[model samples]
Target chain A: MADEAGAAKERKILVAVDESEESMYALTWCLKNVSVSSNSKDTLILLYVMPPRTVYTALDGTGYLFSSDIMATMQKYSNDVADCVIEKSKRMCREQVQDVKVETIIEHGDPRDAICQVAEKLHVDMLVMGSHGYGLIKRAFLGSVSNHCAQNVKCPVLIVKRPKASSGSS
Target chain B: MADEAGAAKERKILVAVDESEESMYALTWCLKNVSVSSNSKDTLILLYVMPPRTVYTALDGTGYLFSSDIMATMQKYSNDVADCVIEKSKRMCREQVQDVKVETIIEHGDPRDAICQVAEKLHVDMLVMGSHGYGLIKRAFLGSVSNHCAQNVKCPVLIVKRPKASSGSS
Candidate 1:
């Protein structure tokens, strides 16, 4: 066995990441505000969900109609965005909590479903996310991803909102 | 000056309160999970927002058509619900954190607007609320109160989710 006697008691926290300033602020807030005492190891799971390319994953769409070039472009675009977000989150966390162990998850499909599914599958103790995001065209001002995950996930959710007037926070 | 030199540094956290188990669990969760070290005094503000009696407040409608008795009854009902919820939250927190200070505010309006307004007016450091509440049929399982506050409020919101299988947590 490893030298760590209390590895079994580690707390797993799932943090959602995206390119939005709010999302990066949430990552920084979690590192600053969340408890990571030395007595028990806690893992911060950074998750970036990419929307599935509709031409490829849509149930009724004809995959052959669009040609492979279009599909490849969309796929590559999502991959690049995912990579960018995860790396940025890593950089942010390093500036805040250098000793904390971090893990990254990049997945495809609906952001809401993907976050909830991963949190449940991993049995995380808590889910942290930005209060609002920039996606969804005609929905409420509140971002749907944070709202849906907060409701469905069986863990406490910390929705970090960047204070409207506070530049000193982040 | 008062004997306490650091009273100005106390953090004011406002927790939205209601009769739902989710809200009560949120209050309990705040006491157990949030920082409450002896060195820093954190005050918890218990807020209960009473939905406005639409018949009395609607601008275009014949608000005057309704008898004063009808308006009074609706007002009384909201008052009763607000009172009951505030009392219940006080009782809940007493059993958890005896030293924590609790304050209750009841206002009549849309729950979404009222919660955000009070949080700003009071200048709370953090807004704690239950993730899912009993409201809105079309929203993805998350309630509108927690969702809207998380989006509009300037303070960080902690949306407590009662873990589905954890009965012993409280």
Candidate 2:
């Protein structure tokens, strides 16, 4: 336990990003706050976990599948979106805290499993995520992402919440 | 936004605690990290939001009334739990970081709304909480508490995830 706590002193922060505004807000908050001063030397990893793509099977459930061409097209689209989000996060890091080293990882799997697996594999000191996500229905799923990640991960998780429509909280 | 960011420089962290082990772990984690260094000077407010206890009401569509004695007993029980949790958290602060100013607030209402309301009212720099309160059934509710607090609160929220049964995570 002491060793685990000691390792935490040197921050290896992981920020889970998607195309959610909440996630972007969390990344910004982390840069301006959690990763500061001495923490600037720490690596802030931007992780984007894309759910494993599943090609649609035949309506008859007879093992017929989508054409390889269609499957490839969808896969390419997912990768493109991942790249865009990562690039935008990198820019935010650059603009917010120039010293903190930033890295990116794009994984394919259940986001809950992928995130916890990556964070554990990296032995990150902390897992930072945003509260909600793109839509109301998606927000509930994102909530599960954070909830599962929090329960499964070893390190402390910082879930930055995005203010509601009012923006009168502060 | 700049003014909000400026105000955040002085860390006013709030940790929401209950009788759950997960919450205790989170409070301990916050003491060891978030409230460290210059943050010691920053105030650490330990908040315990007790859900309003519903006293037994007479079963009728009319003016139902629970006996005052029964109501008083239940309220006292609720208050006792709140006090016990708060006292335990205060002890953690004393043992962990004596320099960090520790304060406590006990509020009776819906845990979700009460937490967000208190955080907004206090304009805390950050809100730290535990994930997965009791079990799977309770988790859905606690998830909403963290989710609601994160979405509704003004400050960045940290939901500390407790290690799972396997504990193979680094």
Candidate 3:
């Protein structure tokens, strides 16, 4: 088990994917870049966070009714989203990398927070992600996940840009 | 004229924009984050490369024959792209800055090389950009722009990540 962990101990790269073309570029880039040496496993962890939804539960006897089904359904949706991200990530990895272990994670909450949490938990050597465009007002008001991650995370972060038609690549 | 040049003194910022959403985010972030005092004029030089089109151009004489036109169009497009960027940047700077001028530059070359050259030519105080994700292969094979910029550029480089959603404005 120790040897397994050590052999699998490649640089932990946490890539946050939003399923955009930019995210896909990041994913593809990682598969091509990270080494799969025996001692340096270079594990790739793909993460996706679902935007949170607020549902009114109950208001005493005044005006609302609580529904367990709603919560259950939300959990199910979370799982489904995770599954989708994992499936897509795995497919991309298979095409680009061989004999490399890949892990997929899906979480429910703010994307930036979830990403930071995972990075800390996994002790990732570096974090890789695609930038999602958020304007100044929106970013100042709502905040940008990438900015937050860059500021807070202990590890170095790699943010990839989407390819342009003139960029000459798919 | 000297005063205008002095007033319009060039402040170099290594602006990296791909067709990616994150690159846009980085541009937006720079517009908001970079400070332009009354004494200093600022130039946000936008840099982009057409990737490796040499192969495709080699195959199709059409692509090669029209290379000059393509370059000219790219220059025009760069101007247009820079116009949009400066417009947005000006909007962000409206309240925060006064008497600060903006200049846009478009170059067709390797993104990293173009950035470094501009930084050197203008003797920039700092290099600011958004990160692009690169895993091992692409990083090893092509090299990451951020990493290369950090290693090659003499000035300090700032790499901004997107803000996290959960964290309130900072």
Q: Which candidate is the best by TM-score?
A: 2
Name the weakest run of 10 consecutive residues (lDDT summed) in model 3 chain B.
B1-10
Q: What CAPRI grade goes to candidate 3?
A: incorrect
With candidate 3 superimposed using the best TM-score fit, by how many Å does residue B109's alpha carbon deviate from the native? 20
Worst 10 residues of 1 chain B by lDDT: B1-10
Task: In angstroms, give how far residue B89 of model 3 lies from its true place.
Answer: 33
Local distance difference test scores for all models:
0.72, 0.75, 0.58
Candidate 2: the clashing residue pairs are none
lDDT of 2 at A31: 75
Query: After aligning candidate 2 to the native by TM-score, how far in Å is the CA of A150 from where it should be?
Result: 4.0
Q: Quick one: ranking by lDDT, best first?
A: 2, 1, 3
Residues A12-71 of candidate 2 have per-residue lDDT tens digits of: 899999998778888887876678655556899999987566423332244455566766
CA shift at A168, candidate 3, in angstroms? 12
lDDT for each residue of candidate 1 in A30-149, tens digit (9 for 90 to 100): 675564333136788999987666636563366545567776777788789889999989887676676788899998767788899999999887788886664545125434777788
Give the worst 10-residue stretch by lDDT in candidate 2 chain A. A54-63
Question: Each candidate: RMSD to true structure?
Answer: 8.1, 5.4, 20.5
What shift in Å separates residue B69 of candidate 3 from its native position after superposition? 49
TM-score of each: 0.70, 0.73, 0.43
Question: Which numbered prediction scores highest in DockQ against the true structure?
Answer: 2
What interface RMSD do all candidates show, one decimal each? 9.5, 3.3, 17.6
Give one clash count per candidate, in the order shown.
0, 0, 27
